[model samples]
Target: MLSTKCPNACIRACHLPAWQKAEEDVKSLLKEKLLPALQRASLKAERARIHNVIGQISGE
Candidate 1:
């Protein structure tokens, strides 16, 4: 949604309370830590698909 709406400008985030330091900390954690972790996990999940022959016996 951000990309579609703000194509002319860069993506913006709200980092209120400049002195809190938590804003920058959270951003770095997301970019450096969580991003890669989620990407890898997603790839593994994508590669995992059902490739078997099975049939369920209904009303058994």
Candidate 2:
């Protein structure tokens, strides 16, 4: 068995087979879930910045 503490806690949380499965799960979630959420948040921030710039230009 492999185990460690500190920053390696994440790595130590799984053995070989479990790690492989977890890697796939994490990849799937990042691609299907996290990426979309991040994209939406980024778009919102960009829109807010554009709105702020427009407001400044209009002297509001």
Candidate 3:
């Protein structure tokens, strides 16, 4: 068992297994969800930019 004070100065007991589990969950979430979501958003923004450029070229 480990005890430490948080940034707010509140003392709490920490469990090793729970901490490890939380870390693994965050890693899994980033790998499985956040990366792809960010990539898709980037692609959409790029496509929109290209579309605007093409429209401007055609208008000129």
Candidate 4:
């Protein structure tokens, strides 16, 4: 969940021309944005795994 209290510096850093100009900016963007999205996805995957394990244990 993105914090309601904005990280203005991070947000600014993400938007800077220098940040955009960096060769690794795409990777940086991914690290800044997609990483959290991936983490959330991983959490969901783990939850599903746990649910499946419980279901199997319960013979469901």
Candidate 5:
């Protein structure tokens, strides 16, 4: 059973048994590894964008 607090993204899995196991495995990976890597990549990309903008403003 899923609580009302469940994220909208995960709501489907709660109603579908076929998706439940795969969802759990993916969630574990996201917690243990994938989410951190994704966050790091996002930060790196944002940093690069900021640097580029600054360089353009400064005529680098």
Candidate 6:
């Protein structure tokens, strides 16, 4: 389904299959729009996980 809303809105509102079958342009734009936010959110969690592992390895 073509998103009448913008990329960010589509990401929040669309279901998985609808997003998967979106037009190439929509997917591309969504990547551009959301990639940074995804990285920001993911990086913090990953960093904390790595810290936990390092502490475990060092017997901290």
TM-score for all predictions?
0.24, 0.40, 0.42, 0.39, 0.40, 0.38
Tell me the tens digit of each residue's lDDT in model 6 across 1-60.
Answer: 222225543222224444333333343454554568777566555545444433343342
Per-residue CA lDDT of model 3 for 1-60, tens digit only, reads 222334443222333344445545554454554467777566556555444443443344
**Alpha carbon lDDT of each predicted model:** 0.33, 0.46, 0.45, 0.42, 0.45, 0.43
lDDT of 1 by residue, 2-42 (tens): 22224673222332233124434443454554467777565
Better of 4 and 6 by TM-score: 4
User: Where is the poorest 10-residue window by lDDT in model 1?
Assistant: 50-59
Show pairs that collide, candidate 2: none
Deviation from truth (RMSD, Å), model 2: 18.4
Best by TM-score: 3
Off by over 4 Å in 5: 1-35
* Candidate 5 local Cα displacement, residue 3, angstroms: 44
RMSD of each: 19.9, 18.4, 20.3, 17.1, 17.7, 15.8
What's the true lDDT of residue 40 in model 3? Answer: 57
User: Candidate 2, residues 13-36: lDDT per residue as tens digits?
Assistant: 224455455445554454554467
* Higher-scoring candidate on lDDT, 1 or 6: 6
48 Cα displacement, candidate 4 (Å): 0.6
Clashes of each: 0, 0, 0, 0, 0, 0
TM-score computed on alpha carbons, candidate 3: 0.42
As for candidate 3, its clashing pairs are: none
Residue 41 error, candidate 2, Å: 0.2
